[model samples]
Target: MNTIKDQDLSKNQLLVKNIVEHAIDQANFTIKNLSKRPTVAMLMECENCLTDFMPVVKFIADDHIEYAPIYDQMCAAIDAVQMGEDLVEIEFA
Candidate 1:
């Protein structure tokens, strides 16, 4: 992916980034308070929200450059949540 900074984002890209950030933040929040590993069904709402933002990320900028980190954060959060890890503590790639 190409490199794109936060300051470089367009209006549309910023909007997409906001939604994706919300998805990841909420997902992390849900898992952070839990004491046990989450089942996929347990994370269904967060997962669904994240999934819904997938297509939006791809359109955020040329080659989806500006939103790559958001996409990565979503993937990492989902993986860690599904794996019973601390979503808030995990540093997404």
Candidate 2:
């Protein structure tokens, strides 16, 4: 995937980036990882952490078909992770 270097992000991309970073921080995680946070499970370490960020995910997913399904799958995985003893490998349809 292509990466936008410093000072090259569009307003929308920057907004999304800031939201993701805020979610990650609110989950008590460090930001030393890569930018390709394709999976919410990859960004969050635990179910509670994912739960903490669900509101932001819902906000982003609302009315955004491109991201809604992805968010839905991650939300399912989060519920599964919380209820079961296994990590669900849920993916976008």
Candidate 3:
């Protein structure tokens, strides 16, 4: 017999799995498209893209951390590029 906790766990796992799979797909696509071997700058560009998307994911998937292994795996896909000052701060004029 399934409990409420079991159902919630299942939902979290599915959410994290979907996120991890998407992250992996994005990483593979970035790796494939490099004109030259990927440089730190190029990878940083990819990281920038990921960071741009992260806020939206965080908002939508606030519950996702309950299934951390999959979340970590998603993070690992682009792990090499650390968040730095290059992530722009937007200013409204």
Candidate 4:
């Protein structure tokens, strides 16, 4: 028989998996729609896309300390996109 701790862990794992997959799909959709826009606009939209899902990632990290790396990755990815936007602005604007 599965213990209570085991059951809780399984549920958390499923929740994390769903959240990550959904975030990936959401980002992908946003990126696909942005492809025709200007480079700067694309980067800005991408930043906004990541920003929108960041809270969900944070929520996961808050409840599941073991998934902190995923949260860190999300932060790094957002920072990189913001940097790209800054570079594009510097180069063209």
For each candidate, what TM-score against the reference?
Answer: 0.50, 0.49, 0.40, 0.61
Q: Tell me, what's the RMSD of every candidate?
A: 7.5, 10.1, 10.0, 7.5
RMSD of 2: 10.1
Superposed by TM-score, candidate 2 places the C-alpha of residue 79 at a distance from the truth, in angstroms, of 1.8
Residue-level lDDT of model 3, residues 4-90, one tens digit each, is 875787786777567655654564455444324456777666766566555545544466554444334335544544632222221
Off by more than 4 A, model 1: 1-42, 89-93
Error of 1 at 82 (Å): 1.7
What lDDT does the true structure give each of the candidates? 0.58, 0.55, 0.51, 0.65
Give candidate 3 regions above 4 Å deviation.
1-27, 34-36, 63-70, 83-93
Query: Which residues of candidate 2, in runs, are more than 4 Å off?
Result: 1-9, 17-45, 89-93
Q: Write the per-residue lDDT of candidate 2 for residues 41-73, one digit (tens) a residue.
A: 554555656676777767877845555765675
> Which tens-of-lDDT digit does each residue in 1-72 have in candidate 4?
667865797786987778776776666565555554647677778778779887887887798786566667
Pairs in steric clash, model 1: none
Evaluation by lDDT, superior candidate among 1 and 2 = 1
Q: After superposition, how far is residue 15 of candidate 3 from its true place, in Å?
A: 13
Cα lDDT over the full model 3: 0.51
lDDT of 4 at 66: 61
Comparing candidate 3 with candidate 4, which one achieves the higher lDDT? 4
**Candidate 1 structure quality by residue, lDDT tens digits, 2-93:** 55565556855667657656655655565554435456665666556556755565455337575677667767766765665666532333
Best by lDDT: 4
